[model samples]
Target: MDPVVLAAGSALVSAMATDGWQQTRAAVVEWWRRRRPDRADGVGSDLEAVRAQVLAAREQGDEDTEQALAGAWRLRLQQLINEDPALADELRRLLDEHVDPALSDGEQPQHRPIIMKAEARDNSRVYQAGRDQHITGS
Candidate 1:
């Protein structure tokens, strides 16, 4: 075989391989999208549970404790989102509503935030105190 032709063939093969890889990646993403829950519509348990826990803590007259817990919870959730990029977008959408509610409007609930999960409701979102954006799911 001519050296020039061989080299050209090798380059063509390499380009084909790169294109195939790109297609595979796009397919995987499309599949994941089909599996992904609606960020705006899907209700998560992680945030709901966190909200309940914070509310309970506050009701127990532990305002400081509640704040600490909420902060830790948010950090952990953010971390989990980092681990699973899809979850981050969902979490962000869900929390966007309450991130800074208009408390002065008297419409904001006095209770804490609710932790929600993208999939299972039984699993709780756990936060590690003193750690920023570090989370573990139950």
Candidate 2:
């Protein structure tokens, strides 16, 4: 998937979990209104429905479901970009100016991949984590 699609999808999901989600949702809907007017009417309703699911999933401790919803959205965005290759720029702007800042921490895990490498030789040890790591026990 395109980086913008990945970031936007993940940020969109994160923002859905926040208190200011209505504004985020509205911004996305307006994007559709400008770029895909034909699909705009339904998009707001669809986003609201998705927001319900996101809340439900969070309540159920079902992060996977939330991720699946993001994937569905990513696919939707990818299709939009595919139809109009130039839309990628618009999507990037949406993600940057609106979607990402909506995140509580301004972090999009899917925005970039993390890779770690270590060579532990001669009684050495290596440990890595994308976020947090604790080594207890000497």
Candidate 3:
């Protein structure tokens, strides 16, 4: 899992401001730079791309994708907490605000695949990519 993603997850659990999210993302970028020095930007775009996709999905009224993204964020947050226990308190607080509400009502949305095309790619990849990945049918 991406450490930057983990940090983002932690932020979700803490109601972190947008600047906090950018800082966490920056740390992840730095870590990625250290690990893959030869890759130039070293996959910096992945996280930004994911963030953008999530925002776009929210704007599109894609509830299922939104929920799944939230779940993924939660998982990443858990991973971050496991990696650094000191953040537990912060994470717990965030969960109290963001996660608990969804759980109490069993309001997690179901995934609704929106496939636009199929060809060289297999169904499994399409499924794994989820709605966002399948939208372009690449």
Global lDDT scores for all candidate models: 0.38, 0.85, 0.48
Root-mean-square deviation of candidate 1 = 25.7
Please provide, for model 1 over 58-101, each residue's C-alpha lDDT reduced to its tens digit, 9 standing for 90 to 100.
Answer: 46876575556545544544454456666544433332342322
Q: What C-alpha RMSD separates each model from the true structure?
A: 25.7, 5.3, 15.6
For each candidate in turn, the TM-score is 0.31, 0.77, 0.36
lDDT of 2 by residue, 22-71 (tens): 88888999999999999998988888888899999999999999999999
Name the better of 2 and 3 by lDDT.
Answer: 2
Residue 97 CA error for candidate 2 (Å)? 1.0
